[model samples]
Target: MAPSSQSSLAAKPLSEFSFPSPEVTASPYPFYEAMRAEAPVYKYPDRNDYLLARREDILFVFQHPEIFSNLTYLADPAQAGRVLASKPPGSVLLTNSVLSQSDPPEHAVKRRALRGLINPRYIHSCEQSLRRIANELIDGFIHRGEVELRSEFADKLAVLTICELAGFPPEDRDIFLSWHRIGTGHGARFLTPEQRALQGKDGPEQQAYIEKTIAARVKEPRDDFITEVIQDQIARDGELNLPYLTGTLRQILTAGNETTSRLLTTVMKLLIEHPDQLAKVVANRDLVPGAIDEALRFEAPTQWTSRLVMADTEIGGVQIPKGAFVFMLYGSANRDETWTDPDRFDIERPAVRELNMAFGGGIHRCLGSPIALAEGRLGLEIMLDRLKNPRFAPGCEDERENIDNFQKRVPKALHILFDAQ
Candidate 1:
């Protein structure tokens, strides 16, 4: 037979399992293991939603956006309003900038506008600047012999990179990063007490800063991505579509920074856990990208996404009503039986890169994935080059539970003592 259908913890029973439960957030693999077998199309007892626990089922949902719409992300007012309420009024535009939120013709237009700017080729062209930014952050504590790797270096690398690519003034990077923490709903639990206090304070300033930048680009275009994008948008619309541009820029900056940081942190953490694998990658840099991709598959940062059911649908033998929410568990699907060793953290896994839902799949896939991967790979390469024999500090080897949320796995603090050279 295949692996046992019952997880050792299955005694708790599937009905009692509350997702986003602090318990499940801390140790999700076992729970996922049972759900895939026992309840592949599990229904939420508390809400009118369904969670697709199996890989094939989730991929089916991803592929059929006609029946399972991305419109739930922002197009549906009830859902969008619920989400928009949490965000600052300054971020109204941030609600619907990503093309992934829509399907078909409009998605194509949005893709054309922003795809070229954030694509892998464009991101690679900025590698020199990225390298300089990585070295600059490392230079801050490389001589100190120890560093809190996640916050000190990883987060800043992601932030500075987004600032570089978006043409934001480098000095305002702190402002944007601060505002971003509050903007991404999954990020609130990861913030410091000080960061929590600064939440509402930075939104207005960040809004004003973006507005100022937009005006500058409109009046006199500069030799930058933002400027070129603004020129194209104005030509297409005849007048500035302020909300659209604002949302697109914020989405690009938000997703790029947040996802890349989490992925980079996870990549580093996995390497620490498997020294043999880490040695392989460190000795051979070609394995860097594969290592990052494997980390994404092993532990996806953003976990589940809720999609609106456009029409009544049946998935994995379970019937879901139209307009109900279907939560596609990217984390669970990634760990399902699709891989030979479903739970193993193997960087050299052949089927992972093309198939993993770490960045989601099909048309609604993450737009900034190329940038996130590039950043993670380059960020890891930079760290391994500088921080020799990096290992966790005693008693601090494990970080806190994943930010008290089911939606994303954010490793906010991970301190390590490194032989910094």
Candidate 2:
């Protein structure tokens, strides 16, 4: 938590580049500008190692896993030292899931089990279920004509969808949300000092819950994702132990449920803001899929991901020492001019497929991409169909003005006045 020790180097000072401060966390673009202009790969005078801000450099870190390891913050001696030296064994953010912790072979084995159930075919196969879930949530609040969009719609829709896939009961949505909120830090590092103290608090209780669930599934397995993972060859191989199973379930719930919920809220808000974009999509429903991509590009749900260096690496003309930490700024990467217009929100932007780093590319790319896409498309399509006349509410405690953060972008509570279809 001290200033950069390598101040005498040839690099310019990134002292002015503010990090997770209240203002920066609320709206980070201004700080991102300062950092990108000063040093695309900045070594803050008062922070950790190089923080990649420019698109190309951020992509380089995300794409190259050999030099920059995914499990760095959790595995690196310095970071791990700090984490262990603290009250808890882990950091505010986690790297214990198969996607976050393992490299190559182990990652492949665990991901293969998940990928089999989350493949494109399976995603399409679940379309009817997705549509039903979407409508079910919408139906609950449609007659009311007024609802808290985040809690009632986006959050509920995503949690229910993920629960159904993970074989958790619909009534346990609140519990799933509780676990995910604790795990992902909710919107950002908004956890107070006291909250941060509880990072790894309930280890045994959570482990026991997952064990019981896995045991119940083992006794009489259902045709759901939990049974699939529990009975998986990798699970039988002893790779999915108590900690691993608990972590993986947490990952699926948080990564899939939270990100998709935020992203759905983002796109809905975007469409309402840019009525032209919404009109275009309404006129040509085919554009819903492309609009989902555009929404993802415009406002990525995940803003930051960290990687630790395994060997000395050079990226974007900056040399990072072996054991240095690299913060991959996905939000900045999405706006890279080398890929698209950078700022234009064009739903029909040709599918050049510029490799949006929103999902964390390369080996660490989300195994739930298909599920995210499905949820996004289905969720958006349902809103489009149900709410014929949608616009922002006159005044209902707007969280919009203060949401340009590293974690959750867009207003947490989006009050939209929609005409019933």
Candidate 3:
């Protein structure tokens, strides 16, 4: 994230740029800015893929799922099979059933099966629990006066909030955290089989536990998403698809935490860097929602998402071949010309009719967005309420690092200090 990173990128040819250049993860905004202007539909040099940076181009791809597929695995089964062949059994079992990875008819059925996730009544009902979870997380760190907000607060709060929604036990937090770490960290593809085996060692126990929960729900229904999905699937398909549930649960357990946790962490970092904005939010708690939106725009948590080009097509005048993976740079698109001074982190920015594409768009737009927003708003509000005059912990500016992911912007550490009551 040094100043030279920007200059280095400026000096390079658009063709010379790599998909995941060394400095992209550390200082992505500058890279995103350049890509948006120069290489809006960049063909990544490393592979048969494209990086879509402009808001217009990304929106076009989002709107046309038929032309550009979300089911990357099905679209290119050869690649999918090769990758899954190396992945751990747990991942191999769960990757395909991911709802966002599919299109129409299939996507519709799965989406409808899990509609309770976005049900207004369910969200409204969970507000109290979400608030309570946020406060409980604050309670753990408020008395300490100094705490690592990433682990103690943001990550824990996100997991617990998802736990509340999924009807997963709060006691299983360590499990969720560990799984998320392995899933999002270096990834299973890079790890050796021995390493992957070590990581997925608990697969049987985890599966058994989930099966037990599903059986319990089958007998005595609950209000949680797991129960909602189970009943709806049975009603639609006349039988339960354990593989479907397994994949959905895997997505819920990991994807649910990654984006939201990173959002909470990044938002906290942004506010601390701009205390004036933090003070404004502190004064007008109503601005909490706006702050979350601005954070989504300014520093999107999930930075890159990929869609398969279903057929040869032109986006921003660039020809993308069939089966080419188009990487939608959400970070870049969110900062596209759509906003005046898109780089500035302004909570006061006028609310736009088309908000940023941080959670994606179309039918495949993030289903967990309502929960993530609610969790973020309530968590930040509680932090402001409980931790007065929060600021960064001293002497760790260079030590803080983002997760080793091009797609996610989560930091490994977010140390902060606050005045205790």
Candidate 4:
């Protein structure tokens, strides 16, 4: 995973701008800055889709769900058909049952039913368990004086926490990781054909596993999140449809784990890279929460989310016709000019409520946001407190690899050295 040569996107015109190029995926800020400054409503050449870079346009699109619809699963009927064909007949993937992909009455109903799972008290109640998991992870590698934080710490912490909440068996963690990698990886346009073909196999396998879990949960309910969803669905709809249940569970497992894991990796990488900021958080534990928030703004995990333009509309004075895909570049909006010193990572930065599009905006905002923040804050606090003088392992920074995807940006490995405790 050698670093790709940097592209001079600042000098390039907006019409030529293409997302997901290898150089942009590695580091996208320059291109985003150029887009925001020159063409806030630039149309991508390849897809004829719109890419909104400014905070105002991105937020406007997110807030105006009526104009910009989330029913994007149906945007490409042929592609959707192909995806559904690979799954079992009754699979929920056949239809979009996930929170982020639904609209209006259906979205409201599903969100309400799933709301109890991520309620404030519920997320707070998991603190002790989260802390215990964090310490256990640290304990495993504390004696080594060096460890790869991505796989060894962040990945395990995020997946285990979500799995514990979802009532997934600990033994099946690797299987879920594979499902996440393949499901997320293959969808990226940047991957080579060979890579995409290899990664494509995981989707059907994951769907099969989800189907089996739903069937098992139907017969016997447990104290896990999946069981709660099942009971809620039964109570709401009078009967359990395995397809619907599978859709909800798939979103929870993948979204719940992947976002938090990437956040952990980003926060840790930012903190370690900026030792001055890291020192401040180490001195005052209260700053950890702010640091997590700032890190999310600095490097949003889910970079861009798309919405289908239901009808002809004008956004940022640009006339966008119907049948166009509007890409809300969260990473770009997070660093928009509205925030002072947008590029600088500052834990002390004033709270910019509703401005940061990292968790998205409006009704479709991430439901697991509270849980992800709690996990990140707690994980960082425990690690910073336990690991003495942690820094990148010598020469490891050059060897670091980023998950090559335009939608999500995260390090594949973050090797760090610290004093053995």
lDDT of each: 0.75, 0.70, 0.75, 0.78
lDDT of 1 by residue, 264-360 (tens): 8878888898999999998999999889989998889987777778889899889999878888888888877666666778888886788788888
Estimate the TM-score for candidate 2: 0.85
Q: Which candidate is the best by lDDT?
A: 4
Question: Which ranking of candidates, highest lDDT first?
Answer: 4, 1, 3, 2
- Report model 1's TM-score to 2 decimal places: 0.88
Compose the digit string of candidate 3's lDDT tens values, residues 201-277: 76666667677778888899987778887877666556666666766776777778867888998988999989889
Global lDDT of model 4: 0.78
TM-score per prediction, in order, is 0.88, 0.85, 0.87, 0.90
Ranking by TM-score: 4, 1, 3, 2
Report the error of model 3 at residue 34, Å.
2.2
Candidate 1: residue 111 lDDT (0-100): 74
lDDT of 2 by residue, 1-421 (tens): 1122221211333575456677666656556655765677887564556778766787677677777776554554775665334321332223334456656655665677677558677678778998998898888878866666877889888888887677877897776666524334222234455545554565555566677887788789898888787667444554434455666776676677877888898898888778899999988889998888888877777777777788887887888888777777777766654454456687887752456777877777877887888889899889989977778878765466545344657575888777775
C-alpha lDDT of candidate 1 relative to the true structure: 0.75
Native-referenced Cα lDDT, model 2? 0.70
Q: In model 1, where do residues sit more than 4 Å from their true spots? A: 1-12, 73-98, 180-205, 397-400
